[model samples]
Target: MSVTQEEDDPFPVDVSLFTDTFCQETVYRLVGQELKIRQVFGANLGVAAPVWDAALFLCHYLGEQSVELSGKRVIELGAGTGVVGILAARLGAVVTLTDLPSVLPQLADNVSANIPSVGWPTAHPTILPLAWGQDHQNFPSEWDLVLCADIIYLPETYPLLLQSLTHLCKSGALVYLSSKMRKEHKTHDFFEEFLQSRFHVELVNCDHGQNIHIYKASLRKDL
Candidate 1:
């Protein structure tokens, strides 16, 4: 997992020479692009978060549809490794990578590494420390899109995640989310109720045998 400093490396090397002790390096392919990712963090109160398969599936769909990502201001909530948000940035969106304060450094590193060198966005993507359900006075008032992946595992976080999404999203903004439907009924029920309250939700696609689902929803009205 350790990345060595090489004089020929194109991207800036801000991460330390040593890899995170608790996390392992993994690779994924999105829209025919290979990306290196970190997995299983000991930090964040021992949460083992990674970019899940559903996220890759969603990314593929976005690519296939030629989604108009250019010049869009995007925010990613609970961005574990910041892959989806980073990909959006690579595709020309102005992305802000966000996670818990403790995890921002690693998330930033991963973003810096995987983002393409060709036609980089004029405004480099930012890494910010944020916790869901908390006050967000310091964050951007609105975003064109709010992207999240694999954040629906915990029952307690469902309400907070929805509240955060509702707070940061602009009027008529799209919210993209991906998750592997868990066994808990509360997770499903939370999404059903939350979508009913403020969004028009639709299932974009689902990967069979993996339980992965991608969804697209738009805010119902200006708050």
Candidate 2:
């Protein structure tokens, strides 16, 4: 689980793993980048909270100099607060930020407030309501990247997430999945299905103490 940092991704490996107190609009200073986002608090806390795994994924993906997200079409599933998607939007990626129907309003609000400053105009950040299992024919399948973090908690969601991941991406699409690996074997169960699927997957990084990992996956070959 040790990460090799050879000046490519200089961000510290000991990133935050847990966050409970929610902020209305917090300006996060990731290793070398800054993102201003709002997390659902007070009565609205029923929907979303700041996720550390999402933060960690951003720190590495954005920090790495070789990784180019500019102009890439990215979609994030279960994008609770839409922080990661907002950051991706800021990085010049046209992102579709999606979640359950109930969470769309708050997620859209955050995306709107952040768009003026950092978003691609040609392919602006879009908000969509996408339940994992439900298929949408209009869903963009030519996405250059599929993004998610800490979504594999529910055992029932294994098939849904896998199906969405496969359906949304065309051949050779890149997927970045992050999660705080829980002991209920949720992540392991997803990996079991992921292994059997046609996508090629690999562990990009792991934080053993936090029981978190970031996995990079791509289609193995043209289908």
Candidate 3:
């Protein structure tokens, strides 16, 4: 699939779907609004192209919690497909959807399609490139809420992810992290050991069938 980049185009498709690439769309209704997401599948896209189960679960969780989103400064780390961040924007939060540099175009496309300029007046989601540990310092630490979903599968990234989270939550930002309990990846160990050591972690929600866990954490200022 070749993406058209015409400036006048309402929805400029930036995704180039090769013979090996495939696409799927999912429409989710949350907080009385509908969000259409495009999930791309390809060998080189890594884990940042598809909308994960944890991301969907977090959307529902946020809606159910009815957390005050209006005017809140929100940042979503590893914002794959921009579903959670877009939903946050729809709920009236000033949201920044971020991921690796390679994933920004697709993330931007999803954000543009869902949160268009005309209908949405207050909240417009911003797309940016954020590589966890390395780029955390480049961003300010004044966000009201920080979000992460299904981004804990890789063991090598644990320390880096922690580093980023620690820096982002430095100014008392609340962190909402959703993860699938993958034993092979030792996901539980990250929460029990590394994360707990640095932050105050609480398991807020869980999907028993999917083995997904949603945690609410804050930086341990005492440390």
Candidate 4:
């Protein structure tokens, strides 16, 4: 998981049409046993792009949607390549792809080029600058779900990241968090802090190889 060793995943990865063996219907393959995503070069403002854990989390999301996400608001915190939010919007959620200000242009460009334009008719994805820990009253609220991937690598940012998660999610809203078990002790620390937060977290099995953990969380207390 030395992301520094590889350049950003080539942009415009195809959103494939996949059908599980048991179900013949085509589902946009956001997550599954086998996963793929389309992403152009990152903003390169620090770093931008999907890492290993992001891929695994997204794969799990594919089969978990029991209801249509149309009109549902989703905010992908730390939306590096904007792929997660893009997949959500592509599924008909009104999505906000939030990241640092420096990452917005690249994310916005990816959204426009891959998904529907921001100004178009139906559910579309847009970008907002949201630094973790800062107030985000302007970011979408009452969101049906919050999606995050690979943002827990830095220990110092854990507090801010959890704080942002609490602020953006409405009561009972679902959150999909995927992180790598790179540093076991640090990972435990994050979960320890996470348990003290307002959300309830549960572990789930994933097809991605070991070292990746996918947790589905929801607000534990009224927001």
Candidate 5:
């Protein structure tokens, strides 16, 4: 998607460039279904404002025939537009879509748009505010799967994210984290250092064009 900049526009030219993709809703096809995600752009929203490519990659991986979703309990961390979690719910997983308190409104709107009010056989996704380490304890650790997409960009949050992941995986929940391999973000270090230390991490898929890598993780028995 492309946006044209106006000479009289008050916002910065660079910001205007993002208008088309971030200022409006987008429709995505996943798991043979369509999801309309509402995206909001603002200075405060940052990366959580729009649906990222990593999230789409994870959705594709989950839709694979080999993967099973029926009856699984899934929780998605940093679910910006609720696409991944919404797809999981449609595929028969009981899902929870979580993010910072500020992001919940848009996330909830996306969930409502994609998931019907009635006739949904599986459990609908629960939209909630989850601030990684701070809120992990509030949620039960019995989830069958934990989903994260493009949430590892901020290095300062690494420890906090690890804390949350450890807590969530305590009951043997499998984690699928899809991240863009951005060099400046040091995304690789998180997996090689913090995550591998506590959980068994494996690279399950990669989308070269998008520079996204999907990793499957489980808590280590010793930990």
Candidate 6:
């Protein structure tokens, strides 16, 4: 079930077929605030790119009834369409959105359209290009929290993803991941084995009654 690392196509099939030339507007409720998000449909799917419901759940868990988002640095890996990462910024965390270079342009566009509206508190929440298991030295070595949603659909990237998370997480950083529980069990088994040794993982159901799990692990002291 592992996916071989294939070169991601820069064009993403076709732009006209997947997205309108104009930006699409959407709303996400987080921490009791209805934050606005602007997104463009993928050039290939023509559907609104999927947002990570798990990240939303985490936001609710962390901010429940709190209005202030202060003093947190966040990084989101595999930020397709960049929704969760942007929401983190809107919530007041200094956020960085990362994904493959091929996917960055669209992600940048989405961030550009929404960041102004959110009035991001500081010169923060930047977007950058990064591939899993690759060099990330240009970015901060540790983040208070790291996020990923539905990035584990392909098993081949699992090891790379895990390694990248280990490298970027701070000493006591919390890692939140969400997936739709696909039929493929290998991906699940692999992560369970790989992460159990390091993280304290838990499954939390979402408002939609879907099982979204949260994985929290501190960096190994010896490492």
Best by lDDT: 3
Q: On residues 68-149, what C-alpha lDDT tens digit does candidate 1 reach at each position?
A: 8889988887787777887888778998888776667778778767866574664688888776777555676568888878
Per-candidate clashes, comma-separated:
0, 0, 0, 5, 0, 3
Model 3 earns a TM-score of: 0.88
**Inter-residue clash pairs, candidate 2:** none
TM-score ranking of the models: 3, 5, 1, 2, 6, 4
> Where does candidate 4 have its weakest 10-residue lDDT segment?
17-26
lDDT of each: 0.71, 0.69, 0.84, 0.61, 0.83, 0.64
Taking the tens digit of each residue's C-alpha lDDT, what string does model 5 give over 1-223?
4345556422212343244434688888888877888888854355778788899888888878357888899999988878888888888889988987767888878777886545455886899898866889999999999999998887767888999999988899999999999889799999999899999999999989888999999999985
> What is the TM-score of each predicted model, taking all chains together?
0.81, 0.79, 0.88, 0.72, 0.88, 0.75
Error of 1 at 85 (Å): 1.0
The predictions' CA RMSDs to the true structure, in order, are 8.9, 10.4, 7.1, 9.4, 6.4, 5.1
Q: Give a tens-digit lDDT track for model 6, residues 1-223.
A: 1212327532223344443445567787766556566555554333225455655666675666352446588888878777777767776788888876666777777777666554776655777888677656566666788877766656666666667777786456777776656557365664577666555666543444765555455566654
Cα distance off (Å), candidate 3, residue 18: 11
The residue-level lDDT of candidate 1 at 60 comes to: 83
Top model number, TM-score: 3
Please list the residue runs of candidate 2 whose C-alpha ends up more than 4 Å from where it truly belongs after superposition: 1-23, 42-47, 116-122
lDDT for 163 (candidate 2): 76
Taking all chains together, the TM-score of candidate 5 against the true structure is 0.88
- Give the Cα error of residue 181 in candidate 1, in Å: 0.8
